[model samples]
Target: MKKPVISGNTISIPSNQEFLADVDLFIEGVLRGYEIDESVIADIAISVSELVNNAICHGNKSEFEQSVKVCLKWINRKVEIYVSDHGNGFKFESIDSPIADENLMKEVGRGLFIVKSLMDSVDFKITPEGTTVVITKAIQ
Candidate 1:
Protein backbone atom coordinates (compact mmCIF):
# COMPACT_ATOMS: atom_id res chain seq x y z
CA MET A 1 0.00 0.00 0.00
CA LYS A 2 1.21 3.50 -0.75
CA LYS A 3 1.81 5.89 2.14
CA PRO A 4 -0.05 9.17 2.57
CA VAL A 5 1.43 12.39 1.19
CA ILE A 6 1.04 15.57 3.19
CA SER A 7 1.67 19.06 1.80
CA GLY A 8 0.60 22.02 3.83
CA ASN A 9 -3.12 21.67 4.60
CA THR A 10 -3.69 18.77 2.21
CA ILE A 11 -3.07 15.06 2.49
CA SER A 12 -3.41 12.62 -0.37
CA ILE A 13 -3.49 8.86 -0.03
CA PRO A 14 -4.01 5.87 -2.27
CA SER A 15 -7.44 4.28 -2.10
CA ASN A 16 -6.77 1.98 0.84
CA GLN A 17 -8.36 1.65 4.25
CA GLU A 18 -4.95 1.16 5.82
CA PHE A 19 -4.26 4.88 5.42
CA LEU A 20 -7.33 5.93 7.37
CA ALA A 21 -5.35 6.28 10.57
CA ASP A 22 -2.91 8.63 8.90
CA VAL A 23 -5.72 10.89 7.82
CA ASP A 24 -7.23 10.88 11.29
CA LEU A 25 -3.90 11.73 12.88
CA PHE A 26 -3.22 14.59 10.52
CA ILE A 27 -6.73 16.02 11.01
CA GLU A 28 -6.70 15.85 14.80
CA GLY A 29 -3.27 17.36 14.97
CA VAL A 30 -4.34 20.33 12.89
CA LEU A 31 -7.50 20.80 14.89
CA ARG A 32 -5.50 20.69 18.10
CA GLY A 33 -3.16 23.33 16.76
CA TYR A 34 -6.14 25.60 16.32
CA GLU A 35 -7.10 25.01 19.97
CA ILE A 36 -10.43 23.49 19.11
CA ASP A 37 -12.35 21.75 21.88
CA GLU A 38 -11.66 18.06 22.29
CA SER A 39 -15.29 17.10 21.84
CA VAL A 40 -15.63 19.19 18.70
CA ILE A 41 -12.34 17.81 17.41
CA ALA A 42 -13.64 14.30 17.93
CA ASP A 43 -16.78 15.12 16.02
CA ILE A 44 -14.81 16.56 13.12
CA ALA A 45 -12.44 13.63 13.20
CA ILE A 46 -15.30 11.14 12.99
CA SER A 47 -16.85 13.04 10.10
CA VAL A 48 -13.56 13.15 8.18
CA SER A 49 -13.00 9.44 8.73
CA GLU A 50 -16.46 8.66 7.44
CA LEU A 51 -15.92 10.74 4.30
CA VAL A 52 -12.47 9.26 3.70
CA ASN A 53 -13.84 5.74 4.07
CA ASN A 54 -16.58 6.48 1.58
CA ALA A 55 -14.09 8.03 -0.80
CA ILE A 56 -11.94 4.92 -0.68
CA CYS A 57 -14.54 2.16 -0.62
CA HIS A 58 -17.39 3.64 -2.61
CA GLY A 59 -16.01 6.52 -4.66
CA ASN A 60 -12.70 5.07 -5.70
CA LYS A 61 -13.88 1.47 -5.41
CA SER A 62 -10.69 0.62 -3.52
CA GLU A 63 -8.59 0.86 -6.65
CA PHE A 64 -5.02 1.28 -5.53
CA GLU A 65 -4.18 3.48 -8.49
CA GLN A 66 -6.84 5.97 -7.47
CA SER A 67 -6.23 8.51 -4.78
CA VAL A 68 -8.29 10.27 -2.12
CA LYS A 69 -7.32 13.79 -1.17
CA VAL A 70 -8.23 15.68 2.01
CA CYS A 71 -7.74 19.38 2.47
CA LEU A 72 -8.37 21.48 5.56
CA LYS A 73 -9.00 25.21 5.88
CA TRP A 74 -10.13 27.51 8.63
CA ILE A 75 -12.46 30.27 7.66
CA ASN A 76 -13.82 32.80 10.14
CA ARG A 77 -14.79 30.63 13.11
CA LYS A 78 -15.48 27.53 11.07
CA VAL A 79 -13.27 24.79 9.75
CA GLU A 80 -13.91 23.37 6.31
CA ILE A 81 -12.66 19.99 5.22
CA TYR A 82 -12.71 18.72 1.67
CA VAL A 83 -12.39 15.03 0.83
CA SER A 84 -12.08 14.19 -2.84
CA ASP A 85 -11.84 10.88 -4.67
CA HIS A 86 -10.75 10.27 -8.24
CA GLY A 87 -13.72 8.31 -9.51
CA ASN A 88 -17.14 8.78 -10.97
CA GLY A 89 -19.32 10.79 -8.62
CA PHE A 90 -22.26 9.32 -6.78
CA LYS A 91 -25.73 10.72 -6.23
CA PHE A 92 -26.22 12.03 -2.74
CA GLU A 93 -29.98 11.79 -3.04
CA SER A 94 -29.81 8.06 -3.60
CA ILE A 95 -28.67 7.35 -0.06
CA ASP A 96 -31.43 5.95 2.09
CA SER A 97 -32.31 7.41 5.45
CA PRO A 98 -30.31 5.46 7.97
CA ILE A 99 -32.89 5.91 10.73
CA ALA A 100 -35.75 4.33 8.86
CA ASP A 101 -36.99 1.07 10.34
CA GLU A 102 -35.66 -1.11 7.52
CA ASN A 103 -32.25 0.51 7.60
CA LEU A 104 -31.96 1.04 11.36
CA MET A 105 -30.75 -2.50 11.92
CA LYS A 106 -28.12 -2.26 9.21
CA GLU A 107 -24.61 -1.09 10.01
CA VAL A 108 -23.23 0.00 6.66
CA GLY A 109 -25.45 2.94 5.72
CA ARG A 110 -24.92 5.33 8.61
CA GLY A 111 -21.71 7.07 7.63
CA LEU A 112 -23.31 9.96 5.78
CA PHE A 113 -26.11 10.26 8.29
CA ILE A 114 -23.65 10.38 11.14
CA VAL A 115 -21.58 12.95 9.30
CA LYS A 116 -24.58 15.20 8.68
CA SER A 117 -25.55 15.04 12.32
CA LEU A 118 -22.09 16.00 13.56
CA MET A 119 -21.03 18.67 11.14
CA ASP A 120 -22.47 22.15 10.71
CA SER A 121 -22.84 21.73 6.97
CA VAL A 122 -22.06 19.13 4.32
CA ASP A 123 -21.93 19.82 0.61
CA PHE A 124 -21.01 17.73 -2.40
CA LYS A 125 -19.30 18.89 -5.58
CA ILE A 126 -19.69 16.30 -8.30
CA THR A 127 -18.12 16.47 -11.70
CA PRO A 128 -16.69 14.22 -14.38
CA GLU A 129 -13.31 14.33 -12.71
CA GLY A 130 -14.55 13.09 -9.35
CA THR A 131 -16.55 13.94 -6.24
CA THR A 132 -15.47 16.21 -3.45
CA VAL A 133 -17.32 16.31 -0.14
CA VAL A 134 -17.01 19.53 1.78
CA ILE A 135 -17.91 19.49 5.46
CA THR A 136 -17.80 22.50 7.73
CA LYS A 137 -17.96 22.89 11.51
CA ALA A 138 -17.99 25.99 13.65
CA ILE A 139 -15.07 26.16 16.05
CA GLN A 140 -16.33 28.78 18.43
Candidate 2:
Protein backbone atom coordinates (compact mmCIF):
# COMPACT_ATOMS: atom_id res chain seq x y z
CA MET A 1 0.00 0.00 0.00
CA LYS A 2 1.30 3.44 -0.83
CA LYS A 3 0.96 5.43 2.31
CA PRO A 4 0.04 9.08 2.05
CA VAL A 5 3.26 11.04 1.86
CA ILE A 6 3.50 13.78 4.44
CA SER A 7 5.07 16.60 2.51
CA GLY A 8 6.62 19.69 4.09
CA ASN A 9 3.68 21.86 3.14
CA THR A 10 3.54 23.00 6.72
CA ILE A 11 3.42 26.48 8.21
CA SER A 12 4.00 27.54 11.79
CA ILE A 13 2.09 30.70 12.49
CA PRO A 14 2.17 32.84 15.59
CA SER A 15 -0.74 32.53 18.00
CA ASN A 16 -2.16 35.76 16.66
CA GLN A 17 -5.48 35.72 14.77
CA GLU A 18 -4.06 38.15 12.21
CA PHE A 19 -1.94 35.45 10.63
CA LEU A 20 -5.09 33.72 9.39
CA ALA A 21 -4.59 35.45 6.05
CA ASP A 22 -1.18 33.87 5.65
CA VAL A 23 -2.69 30.46 6.17
CA ASP A 24 -5.38 31.19 3.60
CA LEU A 25 -2.85 32.32 1.03
CA PHE A 26 -0.73 29.22 1.44
CA ILE A 27 -3.71 26.89 1.19
CA GLU A 28 -5.26 28.68 -1.78
CA GLY A 29 -1.98 28.64 -3.69
CA VAL A 30 -1.63 24.89 -3.33
CA LEU A 31 -5.28 24.21 -4.21
CA ARG A 32 -5.14 26.50 -7.20
CA GLY A 33 -2.16 24.58 -8.46
CA TYR A 34 -4.30 21.47 -8.21
CA GLU A 35 -6.82 23.15 -10.57
CA ILE A 36 -9.66 23.10 -8.08
CA ASP A 37 -12.64 25.35 -8.70
CA GLU A 38 -12.85 28.82 -7.15
CA SER A 39 -16.04 28.09 -5.19
CA VAL A 40 -14.52 24.96 -3.73
CA ILE A 41 -11.39 26.93 -2.93
CA ALA A 42 -13.39 29.50 -1.01
CA ASP A 43 -15.16 26.82 1.00
CA ILE A 44 -11.85 25.25 1.92
CA ALA A 45 -10.50 28.66 2.83
CA ILE A 46 -13.32 29.26 5.28
CA SER A 47 -12.79 25.89 6.90
CA VAL A 48 -9.06 26.50 7.25
CA SER A 49 -9.61 29.85 8.88
CA GLU A 50 -12.00 28.35 11.40
CA LEU A 51 -9.66 25.52 12.31
CA VAL A 52 -6.67 27.85 12.57
CA ASN A 53 -8.58 30.10 14.95
CA ASN A 54 -9.51 27.12 17.09
CA ALA A 55 -5.89 26.00 17.28
CA ILE A 56 -4.75 29.47 18.29
CA CYS A 57 -7.49 30.19 20.81
CA HIS A 58 -8.74 26.89 22.19
CA GLY A 59 -5.79 24.64 21.41
CA ASN A 60 -2.84 26.97 22.06
CA LYS A 61 -4.73 29.17 24.49
CA SER A 62 -3.70 32.28 22.58
CA GLU A 63 -0.16 32.27 24.01
CA PHE A 64 2.12 34.16 21.63
CA GLU A 65 4.93 31.79 22.46
CA GLN A 66 2.80 28.91 21.26
CA SER A 67 2.41 28.27 17.55
CA VAL A 68 -0.14 26.51 15.35
CA LYS A 69 0.93 24.17 12.57
CA VAL A 70 -1.17 23.59 9.46
CA CYS A 71 -0.17 20.61 7.38
CA LEU A 72 -1.51 19.98 3.87
CA LYS A 73 -1.80 16.87 1.76
CA TRP A 74 -3.15 16.17 -1.73
CA ILE A 75 -4.01 12.64 -2.73
CA ASN A 76 -6.51 10.47 -4.62
CA ARG A 77 -8.86 13.26 -5.64
CA LYS A 78 -9.07 14.55 -2.10
CA VAL A 79 -7.44 17.45 -0.31
CA GLU A 80 -6.56 16.77 3.30
CA ILE A 81 -5.57 19.38 5.86
CA TYR A 82 -4.49 19.02 9.43
CA VAL A 83 -4.48 21.84 11.93
CA SER A 84 -2.48 20.97 15.02
CA ASP A 85 -1.93 22.90 18.23
CA HIS A 86 0.07 22.70 21.47
CA GLY A 87 -2.52 23.05 24.21
CA ASN A 88 -5.18 20.66 25.44
CA GLY A 89 -8.22 20.13 23.28
CA PHE A 90 -11.80 21.11 23.92
CA LYS A 91 -14.94 18.98 24.15
CA PHE A 92 -16.55 18.84 20.76
CA GLU A 93 -19.92 18.21 22.34
CA SER A 94 -19.77 21.52 24.16
CA ILE A 95 -19.74 23.55 20.97
CA ASP A 96 -23.07 25.30 20.77
CA SER A 97 -25.56 24.59 18.00
CA PRO A 98 -25.27 27.46 15.58
CA ILE A 99 -28.68 27.00 14.02
CA ALA A 100 -30.53 26.65 17.27
CA ASP A 101 -32.93 29.44 18.05
CA GLU A 102 -31.12 30.67 21.15
CA ASN A 103 -27.59 30.60 19.75
CA LEU A 104 -28.30 31.68 16.15
CA MET A 105 -27.00 35.23 16.58
CA LYS A 106 -23.82 34.52 18.59
CA GLU A 107 -20.55 35.17 16.81
CA VAL A 108 -18.93 32.16 18.45
CA GLY A 109 -19.91 28.48 18.07
CA ARG A 110 -20.28 28.95 14.35
CA GLY A 111 -16.83 27.91 13.18
CA LEU A 112 -17.14 24.21 13.76
CA PHE A 113 -20.63 24.21 12.34
CA ILE A 114 -19.45 26.04 9.27
CA VAL A 115 -16.59 23.60 8.86
CA LYS A 116 -18.94 20.63 8.92
CA SER A 117 -21.25 22.26 6.47
CA LEU A 118 -18.50 23.14 4.02
CA MET A 119 -16.18 20.14 4.04
CA ASP A 120 -16.97 16.64 2.88
CA SER A 121 -15.61 15.23 6.12
CA VAL A 122 -14.11 16.40 9.41
CA ASP A 123 -12.24 14.44 12.06
CA PHE A 124 -10.44 15.34 15.25
CA LYS A 125 -7.63 13.65 17.14
CA ILE A 126 -7.24 15.28 20.51
CA THR A 127 -5.10 14.70 23.57
CA PRO A 128 -3.37 16.53 26.38
CA GLU A 129 -0.36 17.05 24.17
CA GLY A 130 -2.39 18.79 21.49
CA THR A 131 -5.24 18.61 19.00
CA THR A 132 -5.09 17.69 15.32
CA VAL A 133 -8.15 18.38 13.21
CA VAL A 134 -8.22 16.59 9.88
CA ILE A 135 -10.48 18.01 7.19
CA THR A 136 -11.07 16.54 3.75
CA LYS A 137 -12.64 17.94 0.62
CA ALA A 138 -13.36 16.06 -2.57
CA ILE A 139 -11.71 17.34 -5.74
CA GLN A 140 -13.37 14.96 -8.19
Candidate 3:
Protein backbone atom coordinates (compact mmCIF):
# COMPACT_ATOMS: atom_id res chain seq x y z
CA MET A 1 0.00 0.00 0.00
CA LYS A 2 1.22 3.53 -0.71
CA LYS A 3 1.97 5.29 2.56
CA PRO A 4 0.77 8.77 3.33
CA VAL A 5 3.10 11.59 4.32
CA ILE A 6 2.40 15.14 5.43
CA SER A 7 4.76 17.77 6.75
CA GLY A 8 6.76 15.14 8.66
CA ASN A 9 3.87 13.74 10.76
CA THR A 10 1.57 10.74 10.62
CA ILE A 11 -0.90 8.68 12.70
CA SER A 12 -2.61 5.33 12.22
CA ILE A 13 -4.23 2.33 13.83
CA PRO A 14 -2.62 0.96 17.01
CA SER A 15 -4.99 -1.99 17.25
CA ASN A 16 -2.70 -5.00 17.49
CA GLN A 17 0.66 -6.53 16.66
CA GLU A 18 -0.31 -6.33 13.03
CA PHE A 19 -0.40 -2.57 13.28
CA LEU A 20 3.34 -2.55 13.72
CA ALA A 21 3.60 -2.65 9.96
CA ASP A 22 1.35 0.37 9.69
CA VAL A 23 3.54 2.25 12.14
CA ASP A 24 6.59 1.37 10.11
CA LEU A 25 4.95 2.49 6.92
CA PHE A 26 3.89 5.79 8.44
CA ILE A 27 7.30 6.42 9.99
CA GLU A 28 9.27 5.62 6.89
CA GLY A 29 6.97 7.70 4.73
CA VAL A 30 7.36 10.73 6.93
CA LEU A 31 11.09 10.29 7.22
CA ARG A 32 11.37 10.11 3.48
CA GLY A 33 9.40 13.32 3.26
CA TYR A 34 12.22 15.04 5.16
CA GLU A 35 14.79 13.37 2.88
CA ILE A 36 16.21 11.34 5.76
CA ASP A 37 18.63 8.56 4.93
CA GLU A 38 17.34 4.98 4.92
CA SER A 39 19.85 3.74 7.51
CA VAL A 40 18.72 6.33 10.06
CA ILE A 41 15.10 5.57 9.20
CA ALA A 42 15.67 1.92 9.97
CA ASP A 43 17.02 2.72 13.44
CA ILE A 44 14.04 4.91 14.28
CA ALA A 45 11.63 2.36 12.85
CA ILE A 46 13.11 -0.40 14.99
CA SER A 47 12.79 1.66 18.16
CA VAL A 48 9.20 2.51 17.27
CA SER A 49 8.30 -1.10 16.52
CA GLU A 50 9.67 -2.21 19.89
CA LEU A 51 7.69 0.40 21.76
CA VAL A 52 4.53 -0.25 19.78
CA ASN A 53 4.77 -3.98 20.34
CA ASN A 54 5.15 -3.42 24.08
CA ALA A 55 2.19 -1.08 24.12
CA ILE A 56 0.02 -3.62 22.35
CA CYS A 57 0.88 -6.75 24.30
CA HIS A 58 2.02 -5.45 27.70
CA GLY A 59 0.37 -2.09 28.08
CA ASN A 60 -2.93 -2.79 26.34
CA LYS A 61 -2.83 -6.46 27.31
CA SER A 62 -3.89 -7.38 23.76
CA GLU A 63 -7.42 -6.39 24.70
CA PHE A 64 -9.38 -5.89 21.51
CA GLU A 65 -11.28 -3.14 23.27
CA GLN A 66 -8.14 -1.22 24.08
CA SER A 67 -5.78 0.35 21.58
CA VAL A 68 -2.34 1.91 21.49
CA LYS A 69 -1.63 5.25 19.77
CA VAL A 70 1.44 6.41 17.92
CA CYS A 71 2.28 9.91 16.82
CA LEU A 72 5.39 10.95 14.95
CA LYS A 73 6.83 14.38 14.44
CA TRP A 74 10.08 16.06 13.59
CA ILE A 75 11.51 19.11 15.31
CA ASN A 76 14.83 20.84 14.88
CA ARG A 77 16.23 17.83 12.99
CA LYS A 78 15.13 15.35 15.62
CA VAL A 79 12.50 12.66 15.11
CA GLU A 80 10.12 12.21 18.04
CA ILE A 81 7.70 9.39 18.60
CA TYR A 82 5.00 9.06 21.22
CA VAL A 83 3.63 5.61 21.87
CA SER A 84 0.75 5.44 24.35
CA ASP A 85 -1.43 2.59 25.54
CA HIS A 86 -4.75 2.19 27.31
CA GLY A 87 -3.60 -0.23 29.95
CA ASN A 88 -1.99 -0.15 33.39
CA GLY A 89 1.06 2.11 33.45
CA PHE A 90 4.54 1.08 34.50
CA LYS A 91 7.63 2.90 35.71
CA PHE A 92 10.69 3.03 33.50
CA GLU A 93 12.84 1.35 36.16
CA SER A 94 10.55 -1.67 36.51
CA ILE A 95 12.18 -3.50 33.61
CA ASP A 96 15.06 -5.87 34.36
CA SER A 97 18.38 -6.11 32.56
CA PRO A 98 17.75 -8.47 29.69
CA ILE A 99 21.37 -8.48 28.52
CA ALA A 100 22.85 -9.48 31.87
CA ASP A 101 24.99 -12.58 31.41
CA GLU A 102 22.51 -14.49 33.57
CA ASN A 103 19.49 -13.20 31.65
CA LEU A 104 21.01 -13.12 28.19
CA MET A 105 19.31 -16.29 27.05
CA LYS A 106 15.82 -14.99 27.85
CA GLU A 107 13.62 -14.49 24.82
CA VAL A 108 11.91 -11.38 26.15
CA GLY A 109 12.50 -8.25 28.27
CA ARG A 110 14.68 -6.68 25.62
CA GLY A 111 12.38 -4.33 23.71
CA LEU A 112 12.95 -1.23 25.79
CA PHE A 113 16.63 -1.99 25.97
CA ILE A 114 16.81 -1.97 22.18
CA VAL A 115 14.85 1.27 22.09
CA LYS A 116 17.19 2.99 24.54
CA SER A 117 20.14 2.00 22.41
CA LEU A 118 18.67 3.31 19.16
CA MET A 119 17.27 6.61 20.32
CA ASP A 120 19.08 9.73 21.43
CA SER A 121 16.55 10.27 24.25
CA VAL A 122 13.95 8.04 25.81
CA ASP A 123 11.56 8.68 28.68
CA PHE A 124 8.12 7.77 29.92
CA LYS A 125 5.17 9.25 31.77
CA ILE A 126 2.75 6.99 33.58
CA THR A 127 -0.66 8.15 34.74
CA PRO A 128 -4.09 6.73 35.44
CA GLU A 129 -4.95 7.45 31.85
CA GLY A 130 -2.14 5.36 30.39
CA THR A 131 1.56 5.13 29.65
CA THR A 132 3.28 7.35 27.13
CA VAL A 133 6.84 6.56 26.07
CA VAL A 134 8.56 9.28 24.12
CA ILE A 135 11.67 8.59 22.07
CA THR A 136 13.76 10.87 19.92
CA LYS A 137 16.70 10.43 17.58
CA ALA A 138 18.65 13.18 15.90
CA ILE A 139 18.60 13.33 12.10
CA GLN A 140 21.76 14.46 10.40
Model 2 Cα RMSD, 1 decimal: 5.7
Candidate with best TM-score = 1
Candidate 3 residue pairs that clash: none
Cα lDDT over the full model 3 = 0.80
Q: What is the TM-score of each predicted model, taking all chains together?
A: 0.97, 0.91, 0.89
Give the lowest summed-lDDT range of ten residues in model 2: 1-10
Q: How close is candidate 2 to the true structure, as a TM-score?
A: 0.91
Q: Write down the RMSD of all candidates, one decimal each.
A: 1.1, 5.7, 3.4
Candidate 1, run of 10 with poorest lDDT: 86-95
lDDT of each: 0.94, 0.86, 0.80
Indicate which candidate wins on lDDT: 1
Write out the backbone clash pairs for model 1. Answer: none
Error of 2 at 6 (Å): 14
**Global lDDT for candidate 2?**
0.86
